[model samples]
Target: MSNAARQQSSRTGLLAGFVLAALFMLSLFVGVIDVPFHRALADAGALELLLISRLPRTLAALLAGSGLAIAGLIMQTLTRNSYVEPSTAGTAQSAELGVLLVTLLWPSANLFAKSIVATATALLGTSVFLMTAHRLPPTQPFLVPLFGIVYGGVIGAAVTFVAWQADLLQYLSVWTNGDFSGVLRGRYELLWIGAAMLVAAWMIADRLTIMALGRDASIGLGIDYARMLQLGLVIVSVISALSTVVVGMIPFVGLVVPNIVSRLMGDNLRGTLPVVAMSGAILVLGCDILGRLIRYPYEIPVGTVMGCVGGIIFLWLLFRRPAHA
Candidate 1:
């Protein structure tokens, strides 16, 4: 990039960092309870509430949002399709299915076990998706994401059917709808694993960027294509699984955030990944805050708010073609 463009990108990142900081502060003070910052610092009970509930909820939102957005960017890079993400692809549904299976079979399983199973299943499901999507004509770019949606629906239906038989439909509902309302300090620490995966992605960012050039070209460029492919799948699957297991499946943050960041900053993953992560954090945290206020004393799930908002953005992206196209 030219120095001018790099300077502009730096300015944008700095501004976004400020916005994220503001939102983070706002989140701490926005719940139904009136725990003023000063009061929380002064009173032990108020401080406990802030630390145990509010802090964890906001941090979970930040981790899940940024992690899933990076996962989506990796998915797009691997598939060479902009529209696909964990929710639209089979990744999130597969993770849910894994959690359900573990719950049914080992009713006494721990969170770690469930996360492992979910990540494994997510990796499998995503692999299947890529294999099938690869068969579709690239000329018709829309076909890949459409197929992914149908594929995910099939897995989700299986989850629903099993849950229905086991009288665990409520479990299915909770897993399918993302919400941070139940987050507490101990419960949400698992999402930090997603943060670790984000670091892993950054370490291999250049390899991922090259891998996006297609298998033959990437191999010619000295990238171990198959190994990089597995690495990407592992990162995407683990993040999808952790987020789904911890807070349920929050959709569209992945799909929407990366696309917007890519549009503004261009597709060099090394340069753009931070912006994507920050944008995702801002979007999800903002939506979570909106969900809280829109209902006042009650609350809507973040998934519901994103479904409404992200759905509109997705539609706009679908019809908005480039001048070259």
Candidate 2:
């Protein structure tokens, strides 16, 4: 809070931004086609690939990471739980269900309408998880995420059942794992909705901090805790649903990124918002680049890459804590 501290914070902020920007630029050039500056300058085809494919893929990764990271922060703050996130807490499953349901019923709805359904289902799903978490007695440290995973699996099974009956399993498979290969210029514009949610998250971070204090204190301080919680859930729904709808599922981003940020930067959401967003973007973008390079032209999905990496990290995080059961 002092001037020197503020200056130090600013410097750290700048350094993080510089790192993220550098990584982001590296991401734009690492895909199937290597767009060297000179080659792109000389060849219209290379230039077109840069503008259409490379640029959109890069933007999609960044937005998905940033949005999911902030959404993780919001979920953790609202629930007062470190383990809960869109993927584990049933939000992703709910959103996927919504997408599938819409696809089945309307069969011809536009992308935006399907996005609406996805967001709605995600909201319902996350609300159920929060309610369950509220009712259940807190026990072991590992139990919460375990419960979340099981809860999500049940919902996911329902989704799979519907997909199976209709013989749309392959279609459903796309949303379960995320990849940027299909993200062309026109197709990936929906990811901007997630970016917008991130901006809104920054604006409301203080209120979220206050609400996290506990329902009674937040109300005593004249903060509408319920409304804040609602807003937070809606933001989470939009980010998770939109990202899943646009880029499939990128797991553990909300869970892993926010915890890492909190460890490094403390629990002040307002102070750490940019760093959280940057870290999220960096993690996903970095993984996406790794996914592409691992097998060359046969690219693995970013969600699958994150799942493998994040699962290991999650196990380490679980056991690393002395109190975990």
Candidate 3:
């Protein structure tokens, strides 16, 4: 990159960092109960609330958003399609299925066990999508994500049917609806694993960028294509599962954030990955804060908020000029 471009990227990163930090502080204070920043340190109950609820919830949003966004970037890179993401590409639905099965069979299963099963199912589902997506004409990139949506819908239907039969629709709802209301300090630590996965992704960003060049090109360049594919699958699946297992399915963070970042920053994964992560954090965290204040004490789920926001953005992406994209 030229010095000017590097300077521009640095400034962008600094600006995004500032926005994210400001949003995090805003999130800490935006709830039904006013936990004044000044008194929070002095008041034991206020400090406890911040520690137990507000801080964890904010961090969970940050982790879930950034992780899923990175997962989306990886999926897009591996598939060479900008439209596919964990939620739209059957990965999140598969994770939800895994969580549902474990809940039914192993009622006493721990969060780790549930996440393990969910990750496995997500891996399988995403692999299936990749195979089928490859079969569709590469000339039509839109079909890949469309097929994934339908594919995910079928899996989601199966999950719903099973949940209905087992009289666990409520559990299904909890897993489907992404909210941080129930996130406490202990409940949300699973997401830190997703943070670790983010680090792993950054380390391999260049390999992933090469892998995006298609199998033949990557092979010619001495890349282990299959191994890299598997690694990417694991990263995507694990992040999807962790997010679902903890805060439910957050849509569009994965889909929209990556696309927006790509349009603005271009597809140098090494340069854009941090911005993607930070942008995702800001989007989801801001949405969560909005949900908290929109109805006051009666909060909307972040999933609902994202569905509205993400749907509009997805439409805009579809209709906008290819030149802009």
Candidate 4:
């Protein structure tokens, strides 16, 4: 990396950090109750609201964003496809199905238990996708996520069937819509697990980058491609599942953030992960803030906003494929 490139990366990182910070402040104060910054400082209720509600929600958004972004990066790298994401790959839907199962079966499962179930299901779903894909003749890399979308649709249909049978369709709707209004102190803390996963991903970023090169090449280089890939999938599953539990089914943070950052920073996982993480945090926070502002006194869910915007962005990326190829 040249000094100019380093300086440019530093500037981008700093700018992203500042944007994240500003958005966090906005998230804390921009709710329906109109808690002024000055009053929030002195008043206990306001302080409690800030600490319990706004702080946790903001933190959850940050973690969810960064975690999903890193997961997307890992997935894209592992599959060698920019379009693959947890949502696209049926992992998020599988996690939701897990949550629904736990809720229906136990009816009293704690948030931690629910998250565990979701994470396990997500991991299972990802493994199934990988195993199934391994059997098919190699095709376009994009086919992986396209297959995942079909797989997710199948799982989602099962969820709908079960929900209908159990008369819990309304409950399922809540899970699918991706609302952050449910985020509270104890409940939202589960998302911090995603923050921890991001740290773990950073530690193994170099190995992941190597593994992305192809199994034979990675093995020849003395790297255990299978283990590294499994570890990355586990991390991605856990992050995706936990985020789904906290914020419902957010779709494109993983897809969009990592793709954009990789384009800017190059595909080196070690250098790109932080930039992806920061970009994800900024995107989620900004979207959440927009959701809060656009429908004053009755906010739209951040997930809905992301889904709508992300769909458009996805289409744009799809149509604007590389010309030189």
Clashes of 4: 0
Q: Can you list the residue pairs that collide in candidate 4?
A: none
Error of 4 at 232 (Å): 0.8
lDDT of 4 by residue, 50-159 (tens): 88888888888888888888988988887877788998888888998999999999999888999999999999999998777656556766677788789989999998
Q: Which sections of candidate 4 miss by over 4 Å?
A: 1-5, 321-325
Q: In model 4, where is the ten-residue run with the lowest total lDDT?
A: 133-142
For model 2, the run of ten residues with the poorest summed lDDT? 316-325
What Cα-based lDDT does every candidate model obtain? 0.92, 0.86, 0.91, 0.85
TM-score of 1: 0.97
Q: Model 2: per-residue lDDT, tens digit, 259-307?
A: 8767655677778888889888988998998999899978988989999
- Sort the predicted structures by TM-score, highest score first: 3, 1, 4, 2
Q: Give the TM-score of each candidate.
A: 0.97, 0.94, 0.97, 0.95
Instruction: State model 3's lDDT.
Output: 0.91
Candidate 2 error regions (>4 Å) = 1-8, 138-143, 319-325
> Taking the tens digit of each residue's C-alpha lDDT, what string does model 3 give over 92-203?
9999999999998999999999999999999999999988987999899889989999999999999999999999998797889899889999999999999999999999
lDDT of 1 by residue, 1-325 (tens): 6787788688988988999999999999999898887797999988898999999999999999999999999999999999999999999999999999999999898888999999999999999998898789989999999999999999999999999999999878777999989999999898999999999999998888888788889999999888888899999999999999999999898898888887777788888888889888998899999999997989999999999988888778768855454
Listed per candidate, the RMSD to the true structure in angstroms reads 1.3, 2.3, 1.2, 1.6
